[model samples]
Target: MTIHQFYQPPLHWQQFEEFAVQLLAEVYDVPTAQQYGRSGQAQHGVDVYGRSRKHGLIAMQCKRLSDRDANNQPYPGGPITREFFFAEAQAIEDFPHAVSIWILVTTARRDTRVQGYAEELNEQWEKNGIDRTATVWSWDDCVSHLNSYPDLRKRYYRDVIQVNSVDDLDQMVLETISMAFNRTAFELPLHIETPDEFLQALQDTQRAVRTGELLDRKSRHVIRKSIGGWRQIHNRDWQAALGKIDKDLRALRAGVEHGLKDGSIRRTSNYLDFADRRKADELEELRSGCVRDLSAVLIEAGLPPI
Candidate 1:
């Protein structure tokens, strides 16, 4: 196995755009997806477009953002906005092909404002009988996809693909979860911006890690991810670390879903609707504790703390 001290390395903007195309193809089940047009050319707004099994003619505009400043936090005049998406939405109108879903893909953290705006655009466009809908796939969303599809992660992260044992696999899982959760998304507890979306994404995170299995997103069927049944992992240290992370995740998931299901965690399209903010705070605190545990394990393993 190859040795590396780090988990993920920085990717170039062009590389990211290419990676997004491949990822969308996998998620959408499109084998022929490819980049749209060359650089410095007026080829409409889409950076990538392909016909998918589910969404059909999906168009993606990649914005390879930098977390060089703040990984989280955005404002009215920040890097993205409703107006920014509006301009791209208009540009898609000029394209010859009818688009089903026009996704604004970025490498930065998830922004509630952008997500809420996209949700709004989806409603307005759907009502107006527009040709396409809109959505934002932030970096966190991309990471979830990475975790859901291990092949994609291995292909991108050279150091990870070299992992040769179940122990190594657990370490990789820990690394993935560490980076996935160590974000500002879990900052405020029950006051989550898009609770529903968080629930959906968490389903993907649960695909592997401690379980060593994958679940069908729509059905949640527990499919065997590999051979050996329950006897796959043998390393105690790796297992303990992954087990702690999974325990916290299960607790966190239960709390969030309970709040949403029982109407305790408030929400309304873009804002408040859940019934309980206090319970949400408890979940948020659990998330913070999970982050600390992940960092501790990662540091002990000589990897970068999430």
Candidate 2:
């Protein structure tokens, strides 16, 4: 679902830490808790701490190591140093019963160096009569985890992965209209045969104009102006041509604007499952209706009829 695009920076440190705590809580299925080490500051290096029934004490820190300096000068995010993991290892001293610490970062990629350092530190801790381990979750790991929660991604990163905005719908409508005109001008070869075929072709062209799938208000106004101007210049009966198409175009435009007023295309699961069951049939009707005025207007406008 293009989740990786949301791993970019500009997220506040507190927000990042809060999200990390949520992730850790979900992972451990534990009641999340926090502690203050000395005075009012968080204990050791742990920003969030919790205890799991199965895994005992767990600590986590979220590091949004930005690609910009404190002065806002741009730089690389990292190749986080091994010592960073060592510093996080110090947090285990505060939670003497801690089984593991998770260091989450937005800068590094894999961070195997930090993982290796933690493994070595775990071995040393065993010899010194302490038992603790550390693990670093890099940007890739965080994205992979977050992708599992589609609702959470939608809530927090909706702007990052936008779909079906009004502008997008307008583009779709413009392209569809353009394609219809091209087909009317160049396709259909011989004259439509049989009374049924002739009537069906006219219906299709009219339906295409009337369907109103994605033609928004301002875009419809601009398109109508262009078409009206073209008709005025090239056709003697410009009023007749505009009369046949303008009302449908106006309705289509209004429908598109109303559908996209909220700027979100997300649909309820049940609605998506059952909505527009006859979409294919409706589309076929619209496609057939696209050449309704081709014989009269399009040909006179220097675009030969299909």
Over 1-306, each residue of candidate 1 has an lDDT whose tens digit, in order, gives 533222331245678778978888888888888999899987677998899877779989988754343212222224886788788878988989899988888866777888888888888888998867788887767777777776778788656557767666656555555544544455444454576667655555554554344555457654333322112335566557566767777888887777666777667775535565567567777767766766787787678876
Which lDDT values do the candidates have, in the order given?
0.67, 0.48
Leading candidate by TM-score? 1
Clash count for each candidate, listed in order shown: 10, 9
Measured on C-alpha atoms, candidate 2 has an lDDT of 0.48
Model 1 clash pairs are 190-280, 263-275, 264-275, 264-276, 265-274, 266-273, 266-274, 267-272, 267-273, 267-274
lDDT of 2 by residue, 233-278 (tens): 2233643554455454344333323433443211343121213335
Against the hidden reference, what TM-scores do the models get?
A: 0.49, 0.45
lDDT score at residue 216, model 1, on the 0-100 scale? 51
In angstroms, what RMSD does candidate 1 have relative to the true structure? 17.3
Most lDDT-accurate candidate:
1
